[model samples]
Target: MANPTRRLEESESEGFVISGKDIGLRMKALEYWKCAELGLQSNPNCAVQSFKVVIAEALPNQGPNQIDTFLSEHGGPGIQHIGLHTSSMSGTIKKLKLHGVEFAEPPATYYSEVGRLHDILGVGQDVQELKELGILIDTEEEGECSKSPRYLLQKFTKPLFDRDTFFLEIIQRIGATGFGSGNITALWRSVQAYMNEKHHPEKS
Candidate 1:
């Protein structure tokens, strides 16, 4: 989306160039989650390959927000979260909770909606456990309504750092390859809402 108006000559610019302030650059949130994942496999067709690594970045929101405060406290851009993979989200959440790990609570009505419940059960996940554990679920190709549904289950832990800067995401992908927008927005909003309630940071 960035079209540079001019390029700096070899002698005119440093290694980095901060772009000009112009239109069409509006962003709402103060920070966003970025994740990179790698799979290690002995050979192709390996049913389940080991996940070598998953890098997560929490960049400060471009506009005026509390994430800017977090970044300032963090000494610049840094990893604020990590997504851990799990095969059974319900079981994992149950065990983690029993051991005293607190997960972020999604909207209370997240499971109350009938359509959302349908999607969760359609993907062959247990709706009762998901609702009880405050887990978020999302899938694609809703219109097609294939007998087999590809969906993802995700839940976030409360901020691990002293500040509301770092947290962990527990994710389970059932035939889903990419992150779901619904889940991402839900996660971001939940964090923002929590921060606003706890810190009451000034907004520009």
Candidate 2:
């Protein structure tokens, strides 16, 4: 489902607080897809709405792995990757790999730490299964607003097409509404390592 967590009918002002300082953030207008309108009369009393959140961030200097480089190489900025949700990550990964799909393998050091994390919060799936499938796991601690902790597992398909622009992600979230922030950095570094080994850019 193409869901948007936030919607803006008009331009709005927003910023972030970094190191106790307010920093202005850049906002971009992304192209939107048209959907068939629901022909039901809107109810003002019922206060509930659903949407999706598109996360954005600034890229490091003009490196081979930078977003600007990607945009310059590809025609323009588009869907960098698509994340697919699944209930059984291990099964999905096995099936996809059997069909000749290659995935980026996170470093062994990353898994070494997973064992420690598993002790405090239960592992979502079998640790060995995740290792064999090269799946990454992330968890969110329960807070005042949330009653129970959550878990997430994800694996990314290697870049498709010659330009290495678009790719796919297989994800499974348990009691989690937000994407795993920890997974983002871990997976990104792993993907770059994979790219370096396969593509081997002289400078990045």
- Model 2 lDDT per residue over 132-196, tens place: 78888876666577676677788998888788777888988776655554555456667677668
Clashing pairs in 2: 4-51, 4-52, 5-51, 5-52, 5-53, 64-204
TM agreement with the true structure for every prediction: 0.62, 0.66
lDDT accuracy of residue 88 in candidate 1: 88
Per-residue lDDT for 16 in model 1? Answer: 16
Expressed as tens digits, the lDDT of each residue in 4-101 for candidate 1 is: 22222212223212222221111222222222133443343343433433223333334433345457757877766777889888889999999999
Worst-scoring 10-residue span by lDDT in model 1: 22-31
Give candidate 2's TM-score: 0.66
The root-mean-square deviation over C-alpha atoms between each candidate and the true structure, in angstroms, is: 10.5, 8.6
How many residue pairs clash in each candidate at the backbone level?
A: 2, 6
